[model samples]
Target: MKIVSEKLAQDQFTQLKLKNLKTILAESIAQADRGELHNINDVFASLTKDKHEDISNSNI
Candidate 1:
């Protein structure tokens, strides 16, 4: 009985995650349709810069 309940809970969590992912994808599509887009390279570069800044700050 305990095992079954645990499995059910895990399934519910998985479903919730999938639903959230769908919502995010829909929002991204709408944004793209409105010409609100970003360059992938720029996003990566920004993330890398932030990570480097974090590391440098930690050293101080």
Candidate 2:
């Protein structure tokens, strides 16, 4: 995921919308701490699937 992290660092969407990696990681950790951990792995796997069908679906 090094390439993905590099892409995110240079991504215009991330720059305009979010500030930096620390901010994003903090928010994600907070959400995960709030009882949102159960499906995190499964959800991530589903979303990052080759076809990425989960992203097109609202269930994610």
**lDDT values, one for every candidate:** 0.71, 0.59
lDDT of 1 by residue, 8-45 (tens): 99999889867866766676667667777575453345
Clashes of each: 0, 0
Output the worst ten-in-a-row residue range by lDDT, candidate 1: 39-48
Instruction: List model 2 lDDT by residue over 1-60, tens digit each.
Output: 999988987797657535544555566677678866566564445225624663467565
Question: Scored by Cα lDDT, where does model 1 land?
Answer: 0.71
Question: Which candidate tops lDDT?
Answer: 1
Question: What TM-score should be assigned to candidate 2?
Answer: 0.30
Q: Where does model 1 exceed 4 Å of error? A: 40-60
Q: Candidate 2 has which clashing residue pairs, if any?
A: none
For model 2, what is the error of residue 43's alpha carbon versus the real structure, in angstroms, after optimal superposition?
10
